[model samples]
Target: MNRIRVLVVDDSAVARMALSRILASSGRIEVVGAARDGAEAIKMARELRPDVITLDVEMPGMDGLKALETLAAGPWKVIMISSYTTRGAEITVKALEAGAADYLAKPSNISEIDRVSSALIEKIEAVAASTAPLRRKKRPIPPLPKACSALLIGASTGGPRAIITLFGRIKSPLPWPTAIAMHMLPGFTAPFAKHLAEKTGLPVIEVTERVIAEPGFIYVAPGGKDMLISSSGRNVHLRPDEPKATYNPSVDRLLETGAEVWGQGVIALILTGMGQDGLAGARAVRGRGGTVLVQDEESSVVWGMPRAVVSEGLAHGIMSPEEMADFLEKIRSMA
Candidate 1:
């Protein structure tokens, strides 16, 4: 098998060296070159034509965000290397929504470099292997029940962009509360929710504590915690209780609790992600006569989560982000 070609970009020489060494340690990856800044990275990307680029989120003279605009238009996949700071988190979220495939929080010290290296290598492989979502012909959405108490969404990987696109198309207010469980690290969800509010023109709140779930508001699960809804469907609880799941803000836990609370009034949508976190949750929703929709493979960054639901006959329909917005609008009109 051909090793995945990679270009490492960072203004700091130390960062570039560390990243290159990490990638070189992986048998499946080849560090083709390293660039000092965004301008240099862009020039090198054109010349090297690597399969993936690890871009530093902040650099002197043309940062990752600016470089991403050009890199996103290229054939190569881009991953943002971000600092574990509020500013870094905000910029990283923008990069993800803008077109970057994924992001990694830079390690604070040498002790954490090895830990970050494993995750970095894994993300690079996943991003390199991911195919662009195919655009499938729109299908007729089957009739759904008239009453939906909550709209629960689960996503990871390519979720930020997909979620933004879906919400952009939704102009009207939804009759029920919308809760989102996106796989993100702590210190990132707040900025993500802020970005969602800015882009969608909706009330977006990151759940940090128990609160009443209300209509017309988009609730985002806080990163590193699980969000659960009460059986009464009125209260939202944030807990850091689940330790077994690989991803935090557990999608399965959110969907399962949603089903328990809303029962037949639940409408769950599974978007682009890398794993089957939402499969069991979708099952719970379907078993309770609720509707489960998945983003079609042609529109997903990674098709694992949605595919798992579809393969098990759990999805009521498969639709693109725009189609999902239309479906939600139709439901709101009925309500």
Candidate 2:
């Protein structure tokens, strides 16, 4: 079998050497080349034609962000390498928005480097597998969907990775609290929430009744119940009840309640899943003057729920899972 080819780009010689060694040692991956800055990286990426690029966030000329803009115009998948500093985090976020597939935090110590390397290899493989050939070079930007305050996101199969990708694209400390209805097996929600929190730097925890809703924190609905929001003035009331619908932690139920309670303040995002679980619920959000965003058909594994909304014109925007969080932030800012 062919190995996954990787190109390491970093201004710091130590960073480039450390990252290259890690990739070279991984049995399934091969280090194609290394570059000192974005310009060299972009030139070598087109020449080496690596499956993925590990890009550093800061450099002397043509910073990682600009290099991303250039590489994004081509075919290489980019995973940003950023430090733990606030500036590094901010630039990493920008790289994501500018079209990099993912980001990894730089290690503070040798042990941390090992940990980051392991994590980076896993993400690179996942992103490479999800790539679609013959991507459109220039993406036409659509106007931002109508503004909304409350956001409801639904995902099932392949949901965990998709949700993490979504959160990474959005800004932290949002204007309104968001909730997620993920149809995962019981006992997995806590772990999944923790995983999501680590990836996005957002607070994610299993929601219990009366837990206060705060901007920037995610209230992930526990798997065994139907979850909803009950709004009284500005306070959010978490409503967890027995399954009144086909899907446990029914996404439809969540969207229906969010629309009813928040009205025009709701924005529903339907992600990849096996069935039309969130389709009817999207209509509820739309009927209430809320905006609906569906994962584009090509990007979805099953595409049932998102496709349903798109076919019915219920969705105001069609985006990849990675774009949802940033799109939500844009909608909120507009509101």
Candidate 3:
């Protein structure tokens, strides 16, 4: 089998070398070339026609944002290499919005690059495996369930864009409280909630401890913590994620507990993400006879979580974000 061809682009020779080494270590990836700036990257990308490009966020001539726009005409996948600082986060977000496929945070400590090598390899492999962009199936929208009293969602990886796509396409505020858990950097969820509010004109909230949840409001799980449903189902409480848990806002815990509280009155959604975080939780929802809709692989940035639920026969249906809005609207109409 042919390996995944990659182009490493970073201004710092040391960074380029470091990233190249990591990619080289992966048997599935082949480093075709390294570029010092975005212009050079564009040139190399055209000539070499690599499968993936690891582009730096801050380059001297034509930053990753601009390069991404120019390269958007091509089908090659671009994974941005960004710093861990605040400005870096902003640019990384912009890069993603600018058409980049994904991003990797540059740790302040160079030695730590080795720690994320496995993840780097995994992402490269995942991106390369799906050579084409996901294709959304134009399926007939299913009938509505009239009794859903709550909505819960979980996403990661390409989550910000997915959430925005979903909420923006939704035409109106929901009649039930909606909660979301997106694995994100600490301090990013506030801005995410703000973005949602600005785009959707809904009451998007960042969770605080012991907040009473009401209909027509949207609650976002705070970064670096877990938000779980209270036993009453009408209230929410925030607490630290389980000590051994890898997902800060554990989707499994949230979905399972919400299942216990709402049972058949709940609707759970698993969106674009890179792992099986929602499967265990979704099982609980499915067992309780709740509706579980998933973002189909063709519409997802990463199809991991939703794929798991669908593969396990836990999802009621899989569709694009815009279609989810129609589904919810149908639910509302029945109400």
Candidate 4:
């Protein structure tokens, strides 16, 4: 099998070398070239046509953001290599907007290279696997229907911040129930739900085994099990079941069942997360005439989940967290 070709671009010689060594250690990836700055990176990208590019946010002459725009014009995955600092976080967010796939921070101490190497390698491999092929030529979404009642949301890493941002933006008091299936530690779901409630003014609570779904309330799934929507006559219920997929509180599982219960009245939202866990489920929602909303790549902490839906043309709207709440309220009003 051919390995995934990689190119490293950084101003720091040590950083470039360290990143090169890490990629070289991975059998699945081959570091084809290394450049000291973005200008040289552009030259190497044109020549090598690498499968992926690891770029540094800060550099002399040309920076990663500029290099990303140039590289994004071509077919190549760009992962940002950043240091651990406030500026690093700010620039990394910009890199993502410029079309960088994801980011990994360099450790403050190089001696802990062994500790950081494996995690970095894993992130690179994951990005290499998901970031390509999903490059959308254009994002074409379906039209939102006049009426929607139930809403379902899914997310993973970097979800906490995104969720807070999202919940804060939900200005309309919901007229129908909302279900959230986020990938998080098992013990943290209750607190997370309460936190969301406090932050968003939405009444969020942990789903109990037999609790009936009520409008204006948010139900979060427990970490170890999958949450599904069940129908008792015309009323919907929230309950946890055995795990059926890699992620607990699997987004697909919730969406599949919710679509059945709510039908076209369901509105599914895919937020920032890792992997394509919700793509199939979002497709199901679209097929049933339900609307699917994806968090646009620019606003996401991680674009993997929303990117999956956007690439498939199943999404009805690519919205920012700030805009989603008001959008959802419109749906509520129409319903």
Report the number of the highest-lDDT candidate. Answer: 1
TM-score of 4: 0.60
Instruction: Give the alpha-carbon lDDT of every model.
Output: 0.90, 0.75, 0.84, 0.75
The residue-by-residue lDDT of candidate 2 on 132-226, one tens digit each, is: 64353334444675655677889865566577677877667566788899775455566667666777788777775656667666888876776
The true-versus-predicted C-alpha distance at residue 272 of model 1, in Å, is: 0.7
Best candidate according to TM-score: 1
Higher-ranked by lDDT: 1 or 2: 1
User: How do all the candidates rank in terms of lDDT, highest first?
Assistant: 1, 3, 4, 2
TM-score of each: 0.97, 0.57, 0.91, 0.60
State residue 92's C-alpha deviation in candidate 2, in Å: 26
Least well predicted 10-residue stretch by lDDT in candidate 1: 131-140
Q: How many residue pairs clash in each candidate?
A: 2, 0, 0, 0
Score candidate 4 by lDDT: 0.75
lDDT of 4 by residue, 1-335 (tens): 88889998988787778778877887888999999989999999999999888898889899888888788777776877776665665566556545676666677775555667876676666655653344333445445577766888898755666667777877755888888898754555665676677767878877756577887878888767777887541343454445555788789988988887778988898998888989988988877778888887665646888888888888888877767776765665665
- Which lDDT value does model 3 have at 312? 98
> Over 4 Å off in model 3, which ranges?
134-136
Tens digit of per-residue lDDT, candidate 1, span 56-92: 9989999999999999999898999998899999999
lDDT of model number 1: 0.90
